[model samples]
Target: MDKRDYYEVLGVSKTATVDEIKRAYRKLARQNHPDVNKNDPNAAEKFKELTEAYQVLSDPDKRARYDQFGHQATSGNGGMGGFSGAENPFGDFSGFGDIFDMFFGGRTARGPQRGEDLEYELVIDFEDAAFGVEEEIQVPRTETCDNCGGTGAKPGTETRRCTACNGSGEQQNVVNTPFGRMVNRRPCPVCHGRGVIIEQLCRECAGQGRKRVRRAIHIKVPPGVDNGTRLRMPGAGETSPSGGQPGDLHIVIRVRPHEVFERDGTNVYVDVPLTFVQAALGDEIEVPTLDGKVKLRIPEGTQNGTSFRLRGKGIPKLGSQTQRGDEHVRVHVITPTGLSERGKELLRELGRELGESPSEQTRTFVDRMKSFLGNS
Candidate 1:
């Protein structure tokens, strides 16, 4: 059969750059690879033709000759001598392994891999989160078996080398292709790439090298750790299946909402109820803080929703023992409700003394809003 043009085979123009040629070849090779398209009888032939075109065009010297003399340049001593040989027709194509690995489950010999990490949602009280606390938490994780010493063998009997792969943990498959035998190395099926076969199963762990057990781990939670804060505990997770280093345990902090206080990063906020008389006259009143109740001065004419900062009275800063956050005490004036006749009379008298007319501040605010609203 007559061979197709090299550029036409790869679907690339003669002026296409080396990178463009490589990209086009990879896309076509992946789609037409014999293993990927087993049902298509012509897939292997197409793939072989694509490889032949790529081998010549990819090399600069060969490509120059082919561009000048066409298929005549690839016929003699300078030619590839057809695809049948001990030599790989694909040449130094680096992307061949990637395509091969993708089609066939290209897993190498299994080695000791690190275990999976674990996440535990630790619900701590608001006070506990504000103040650093050492908590002993019970974590369910996989640990190496004590009886068989993580060998998955009986106490007396020992594990033997895998006969299927000859203890190499991998098996090489020789595939007969048009371009000679291709060797594909993958993990052994008998030993599952462990290189050893355990004839006697562990009595305790039931052939598995690890067992599930609940372990108590102490975690020192730092102060000012807000909700969703993750505390990583190294080597405190599940034991590795292949005997590598254990994974880390992530302690995700879930702070219980406080009844009295709300926290933001480092600062703490608390709404304190104040009597109208206390707000009007100004008095030293006790307000709740993270530490304890602290005396806050209610200045005369303190309005509702007035916030006062109590310096260094909030939650302690994380990782800094000396630095602390301020506590904001927002005062909400409690209006006198279900008042007696005498109480009402006293308030009326106080109101009359204060005057019913709008204050200077109130009049200025009203005028600004009227102007903003385009009202007279």
Candidate 2:
């Protein structure tokens, strides 16, 4: 059976906002969830479909690719961009953590929450990306204050329960609807969701409980990393706002342009310009490889734009150290120009000695032209 459209699966429009999609998925998931609907045999399948649709539509890159290429582009990759569903769409959604939070209670225990994730684009040489390199980088992140030990209150001062929310960390607003009064719960303005008010601000962090610091981090880039590739480093992001786990740091790879080589996935491509005589009469040629120069055999009567592959001369596979890609060399025949009088005469004599007829290239073009003009 053909798969249903992702938008249709989630009952959302294609132009729906991220928040809208999330809310729709959550509402439907609660209804069709296997645990919620044990009597319905197909509830598990429906929940899976909802999760898959939410995962794809929630990611910006995957959604763009799906919009252009449809499901054919995003399937069979385990997940988009080599990641599992637990990491994206819903950050740190492993073990259905967020869903469980909603099913049980929302944000009831407000201990140290995890820090925010950070992204940095690191540009490197093409060779470095092809191989591997270790480099040191400086990243600016917010860390817990040392003066007050992560507490916003000043030394010897204590935090008191918020007067507005009465230590609930949230404020309730009652609105009168047509049916009845609707109550909306929001974070307390005085406590800012902390449920407590600091009498005096910390001297160092100004009551923020965190300070901006530039930290030096060392990163080891693996081989065969391509542009836009994101590497995750755990515990390297900003410190938790309330004292929880630190978020992961993501570094995006950007490879510099090479003068002779262009990379496509695991393959490397290079153009080799050969003289007409060399192409017509086979010769052993020296070709440039990433490591060093190697001899390449040019077959006799080799045509222009003939490509040859050198195995195991390209980049290593991303996760496999033993497997490597091939290097492709495209040989282009260069026609000699700026001929002297003697050189032209010699060429004319050689043409007559060989044959007065047109070469294969010229004959093929002439035949096409004649056919196009209806003179064939």
Candidate 3:
């Protein structure tokens, strides 16, 4: 089959930027990957086709040549992965490291690469979840070394050019084949693609360029932050292995269980038990809140399982809502288990005077069955 245009294969224009090209290639690779669709026999062929197209388009020099002279310019030249042995396909390829680093999550020729981010789990009290509070947390992480100034080098010395790659950081070779000569590029083992190497390791950081230490960081957790919420602290993560830049620290919120209250998102839920007399006579009772105790009134004849809402007493707003959530207190009327002799006599007299009986008070399906049977 005739080869498709490189731009069409990658779903991009010829003028697409390097980042755009990489994004397009990654998307295609994922869609047509053989491993992802093992049942499909054509997936591997499609992947190989796309890979070949990307090899030329991803390279600035090869892309430029292909753009000017079409396939004839790169006919005899090898594609990206044509080497039989260790060779840098990108030996003459400029702007290659930046593209590689962006896709593969590593430091390339790009300067000042940020460090790896760290995550720390934090547990807070129930009251703290309602009302925002500040607390200091001790986080053990890899931080930039102060002794060698984040460089993994001994004092009064610096990195030298790698002899293996001759400062190119990549080894390149051309392979002779029956069809044509193919060129390939691979990272130099000695230099590890850095183009430079430290002759003497740093004494303080042990040539790793970082030191592990504990830091006291104060975090202001906003109200309404529920369990599993994450707060990001910039420049608080581990130091970059290449001494490029500091990473960020992620604080994972773990709200401790409250004795009386349970939170669901920004809303607060609590179960309040009330006496039979209090529910019937209507009385004010003390309700616990994040700030302090507050008074709540129960209306007369308030049945069990009744819920009363206290507006603005629940958890605070996250980022969108301006008003706070309301607190819901579910009421459960408790009957007295133990009664004195005087209380029993008074209850007997009241029941007698009020004519309260099983037949008069009961209106269940059994009572309807009696009516249906004409026994009522």
Candidate 4:
């Protein structure tokens, strides 16, 4: 039986562009993928057909040949997995760059390209996070060479063309088969595909046009930047081998844990322990803030877990001077523990005078529970 038309199978028009053909194939492949449709036995076959259709229709020369000779032209065109051997029915590898870039993301080739981005972690005190600070950081990196103007040549001489590729930068890889000819294009390994070689090397950079150096840079950290925040320093990363533009430097912030306070977003929370006497009698207590020690008044009969809000006392909002967050102080009344003999005796005497039992609250709770059970 004759096979289905490739364009109709992929649901694309004859006039569809290469990009449109690829998009349609990807959509159909995803829908009919074996992993997505495990119950359907034909899913694998459908996916294979979609890929084959894409491989043919996406190429200008391949599509022209198939249009004229039908399946005879693509029968042995080496169209990946299906055809036996017709690899290079067409003869150019320029179109394959986009396909490779889509899958590997620039990993296949690297020359005269920018250096990879770098990340640095910086630990700062809480005070610095609350109130912005300017700091000097020593960063070790490679920089472009000043001598020879980063051309990788000696003071007066220039580079020479590569004999392997004749300065074309691309090396044609031809595969001969009984069905037809196939071609694969890649960077020429010799001379690194730049189509040139440095016959005269630079004394300063050793012909690399870059060298390692350590430099100190002043960075201003914004206020309210919490841990895990990133600050970008453009063009501060390692230098490229070919003296290309430098990559970016990312500074990741790490806020040190404070001894007395914890941070949640812009709000600062602190647990303040107070004695029972102090909570009952109400006293002015000293509390620590980012600025300095400040007095906080505790109301009489203040209960445990009671929170007090101090406006404009927390960390300043990033990039704004007029706005600030609040600080919450949670009161935790502390009960006396491990009392002395004299203290225990005085406490017992006072309890008897006040007609208070040592387990007054607990006994009252038990009594309430009994009444509830009886009612039930």
Candidate 5:
């Protein structure tokens, strides 16, 4: 069967940007992944198709050739699964590391890895979510010992290389089975993979070269940060046991509910109460905003639920220049109550002048009811 067009398979246009193609490919690949859809038998084939489409379009040269000659440009290449040593047949021959590497920035060279990353949740007020705030927090973590200076030795002592593993930090084990002879390697037990042993242990940290300490970290919260927003602080996590790089510290944000304003993305919504007289005969009203109170012009016949927009009055956009959303102010007309005798008399006179002529809204409702009754 003829293969589908590369752009069509990835659900992208011919003029689609590289970033657009990447995003589309990631979404489709993640959705049709066989592991995610185990009940579907054809999910593997679907994922393979998405992977092939992504592989061709992601490369500039391949994409240009495919665009010029369609599938004929690469028909000479064997079936997608040409590699003999592939572990996964449906993952574009790269297994599951692609997604993790793309999002997590990938790992470093093969060796003793750094410490594990740490995360902490922080709940800030609505004002803080809109505007930035500075906070000092205490974090309990592992730090290099002050006594041994992370060397695990006493003041005048030194460290010696391990003889068992020859300072290579690994031990190889050989086993003979029916298949063949197999060799396995693991961290050396002596010196614990550090390749060195201290003659005299440090008194403060007890030869661990690290100690538990409570550190004070100052964080600068940026404006317009929403819930689930993660902030990364480099080298703020636990120190590596092998003296490598320290992991990062992640801060998750949780914004509290506001009393008057409700935020959706960048926009903000607020309910502004107005008097009946003001609704009938237009008036200027003051409404609350993030910056301050602003005057909103209430046009004549502004009924309940009428909304006005205040441009550039909402929350600021994250990592943008002077870009902001508009604030929507919904009018809620308040009825009169607890009227004095004089006020009642004046209302009675006004009611007589207006007669029983209902407003346009009421007239439309009556017409709809009449139409329904007639049809019934």
Candidate 6:
């Protein structure tokens, strides 16, 4: 069959950038991969064609030559520059493992593997999140066996080389394909890719080389860590079965909501209720903060919903000991209820002295609105 144009095979323009070409190739390759489309008899051939196209277009020198001379520039020995036919089709393909691993799992080799990572959700008080706290947590995980010193073999005996693969830990099978012969390598079934066999198993771990136990771990909760924040502790996860480096423990934080304060990022917000007299006249009132109660000055003629800022009174920035956010306090003026006759008369007299009238109040409100609109 005559070969299709490289650009047409990848469904990209001749002027497409390298990134665009790569994206196009990856999309089509994943869709037509033989393992993904098992029912499609021609999926493998299509994938090979896509790979061949990407192999040429992705290389600057090959692409420049092909642009000038077409397919003849890359043709040699019934292949594209010794990359097809009997040669390994993936020999020059960069990042092949990144795409192929999704379909074929991953490469199996003889070595110690890292342990599995674990995740834990920790619920903490809002104040604890604002000001850093040290917490001790109990985690149940697998630890290296003490009996055999993580070797899986009994104290006196040692592990022997795998008889099935002769310590290589890999088994190869020859596959005949349209391109040519392909060798598929997989882990040895008998040794499970360990390359060694334990003759006398450890009595405590039963040859697993690990035992399950609960351990107490201390974690430092940094300040300004809001809900859903994640903290990673390395080497605090399950022990490696093959005695390799351990994995990590991931902690997800959940901050309990405060009754009086709300947090946004490092900033803190709170609503303080003030009596009508306090809002009309100046007063010094105590306000709650992350540290403790602090006195804030309320200016005379303070209106409802007026916000005041207290500097350096909010949550500390993560990793910063001195830098902190400001706390915003919004005042809500409360109207008095069930007033006494004497109180009502005194209020009326005060209103008269202030020249309170319906028309005057409307005009004043209108003027304030106009001033606000003009400024805006």
Best by lDDT: 6
Q: Please, what are the lDDT tens digits per residue for candidate 3 over residues 1-376?
A: 6667889999999789988988898777767755456798888678767766787887898788788877666554354435223333334323344433433344444455678899999899988866778999999988767787766678788899998999886776665532233345677888776677988878998875678899899999887788888999998887776657789999999888988988876778889999988988999999887767999999998999999998888887876457688889999999887899998887778777877855566666677888889963
RMSD of each: 6.0, 15.0, 8.0, 7.6, 9.5, 4.5
Name the 10 consecutive residues with the lowest summed lDDT in model 3: 84-93
Per-residue lDDT for 93-189 in model 2, tens only? 4535566466445534556678899998999999999998998999999998889887778989988888889888788776552223334467788
Off by over 4 Å in 6: 16-27, 59-61, 72-103, 108-110, 153-162, 167-170, 195-200, 357-376
TM-score of 1: 0.72
**lDDT (Cα atoms) of all candidates against the true structure:** 0.85, 0.84, 0.76, 0.79, 0.79, 0.86
Candidate 5 stretches with Cα past 4 Å from truth are 1-112, 158-160, 198-200, 339-348, 357-370, 373-376
Question: Against the true structure, candidate 3 has what lDDT?
Answer: 0.76
lDDT of 6 by residue, 188-223 (tens): 999877679988999998887778888999999998
Q: Is candidate 1 or candidate 4 better by TM-score?
A: 1
Which whole-number lDDT from 0 to 100 does residue 144 have in model 4? 72
Instruction: Evaluate residue 277 in candidate 1 and report its C-alpha lDDT on the 0 to 100 scale.
Output: 87
**What would the per-residue lDDT of candidate 1 be over residues 1-376, giving only the tens digit for each residue?**
8889999999999999999998898899889988778899999899988888987898898899898888988885436525434335543324466556556665432568898899999999999998978999999999999988888788999788999999997888877775455667877999887689999899899887788999999899988888999999999988888778899999999999999999887899999999998998899999888888878888999999999999998888888988999999999999989999999888767767877534755898988999989964
Itemize residue pairs with steric clashes in candidate 6.
Answer: none
Which is the better candidate, 4 or 6, if ranked by lDDT? 6
* TM per prediction: 0.72, 0.67, 0.68, 0.71, 0.64, 0.81
Better of 3 and 4 by lDDT: 4
Cα lDDT of model 4 by residue, 44-88, tens digit: 678667767877887788899888888777774344325433443
Model 1 bad stretches (over 4 Å): 1-110, 173-187, 357-376
* CA deviation > 4 Å runs, candidate 2: 1-111, 156-164, 174-183, 357-368, 371-376
Worst 10 residues of 1 by lDDT: 84-93
Full-model lDDT, candidate 6: 0.86
